[model samples]
Target: MAIDERSVHGGAALVLRLLVCVVAARAVSAVADGPLLNGNFEDPPNQSQMSGSVVTGEHAVSYWKTSGHIEFICSGQKQGDMVLTVPDGSHALRLGSGASIQQQISLTKGLYYSLTFSASRTCSQNEMLNVTAAPVSGSPAQTGELPTQTVYTSSGWDSYSWAFRAEAGLMSITVTHNCGEEEDPACGPIVDAFAIKTLSQPEASQNNMLRNGDFEEGPYIPPDSQWGVLVPPVDEDDVSPLPGWNIMAYKKSVKYIDSAHFAVPRGARAVELVSGVETALLQEVYTTVEGSWYRLEFSAGDADGCASSYDDGSSSGMKVKAYAGTAETTVDVDFRDAGGSKRGKIEFRATASPTRVVFVSLGYHTKSDNSGTLCGPVVDDVSLVPIPQPYARRLLL
Candidate 1:
């Protein structure tokens, strides 16, 4: 029984090679957790890579690729008489007319991801940013044009969220300034605090027939931001920034607020209908039995201290109208109420298979402080449950 040394050596080498292959494969498939790299734009570019504030090279900004007229802006940097405002950090990137910046990210295919970023208009009133996520396979990209004309915060900076389903394992997220040539090449939007969050698919449970009823699962909000994230209007529910809900109205957006910034009714997050009737938050709950009676419960209130005055010296108060299929009800919460929020309910018979539930603000409101900031009723803790046939019949009788 002679043991061949060559055979033993060959086997040992094969095992070592297999181990190395496994380790390399794991490294290639591993995706980074948390936000994207250098998301805040705090990492400065080299002096050689920058001509004053304008980035000259393609990869001038750390962890990002730049093209055309891109500028690295600093907090308090003055452009003429106006000083720049950096919401997330001391530094941000500005995409001039036709300029763009992008970064390649590793993502899990088939998973839905929400990209949250802060942007502010620098010059033109109708400035727009084109955000896109392109896969490496050359498939159709997911793109959205977000308008910066409507500023939500007094700081002139508003955090926005957009969601898309990943088509491949590797994709590039790009933000491009859509404006044409202007008198000032530097006139554009300042973008900062880019973050990404993988959203969990919401489902109906026994406790709550609606998905994400508490509004706890949604886009990523910067911890230091005083203003909540704005969930931009989207026609489809699958691509909505807010999971399980869609912004059904055009030229309208709903504020996805956090308890840290505003008082939430029941959970850490809630939806504020800031644009009155223009803003509509809708969700289609499935598994609803037709002709079955269901009770919809929710909390409506004023985001305390959000606006200087809730009343405009008129009888029109802050109110929210909830619509369940064909039935609807309005809930009014006084601005002077001690409690920040009040619970409201609406009972209706399901008219469709997947009944549509919508919440809309009743009247247009602006802050009494003369800031002209939009304000409306805050909605939270939404729940829908089917009532027993006997109980429903008794109530009807």
Candidate 2:
């Protein structure tokens, strides 16, 4: 061996130089990854569903995770956007088993951007890799570009992220992965983590916790409405019809295995407003406020979108519970429309009694999912106010 000219310069100076190089490299790497937002994952309120909001049943997912484990794939997606390339490639999450693909974060307003992930067509047909995104509010999303294209080794956690315009109310976000048509098996096309993030919450909203595992935080349908606080959804077998007395509207979220959630009087056709459609509770109410003009409002999003989409999605008469101590129960409607403003609504009336009612619930007309699955509306702002009574003779032909 020969003596090297680039030898240790009195040890200390050499160490200092090496440290400087390491620090520089780290700084550059950090800048390359861009800035990150500090935050915590949460759930919704008042019977709001959480079954599929986050996952980790397998493939390293989130199991009711708050921090550490990211909000990988919200909206009932288990395998998440992180999929196996086929011939055997996977990831490990600190919380769950499968890999995690975090939601596309929205830091500032009006900053458009793109996202990307990694995977290899290294193996054969058994593996498949694809990319997709959730349109923030559970709707159809647009397409963009990817950063580094190919993947076969542990290139570390490097994803493509840029600024974007949060045209939407900035209420929600989503994440999709590279896993589409299974071309073959050996193509071994799959990925573990599509994305990851660190989110930060505002100062005041902390008290307004959205997902404290209780479904209470909300910009809810009835923003001013409060839960029974004393009365909640009775057990599946608990035949507790929402207390009719001292009540205006009682909408509750029913949690079950999937959107196949239904109630007693099956085949009776429940109508309007249902969340976690894959499996949600049945909202049953007593109404018939005609003359006493009553407007029943119901809005549900991402409830039952999978196998159910309303093409001409219209809200019609509701199947309601008729009151007991009332006369001439069939409340008539002079005019009807779901406000045509919000994502959902409906109106009912009772030209006579003040307390008389008609029962109302959700029913599906077209179950073919003309609308996007998971595109259910969140019900809110249900109200009742007396509208001007029209002349009875003018109502009919």
lDDT of 1: 0.83
Across 207-318, the per-residue lDDT of candidate 2 in tens digits comes to 2111111122211011111111111223333212121111122323221111133221112112223222222322222333435544333222222322332347444432
**How far in Å is the alpha carbon of 224 misplaced in model 2?**
34
Per-model TM values vs. the true structure: 0.88, 0.23
Encode model 1's per-residue lDDT on 164-251: one tens digit a residue: 8989888888899988556787779999998888888888899889989999999988888777888988866348778889887666
lDDT of 2 at 95: 23
TM-score of 2: 0.23
Candidate 2: list runs displaced more than 4 Å.
1-196, 201-275, 279-374, 379-397
Top model by lDDT, which number?
Answer: 1
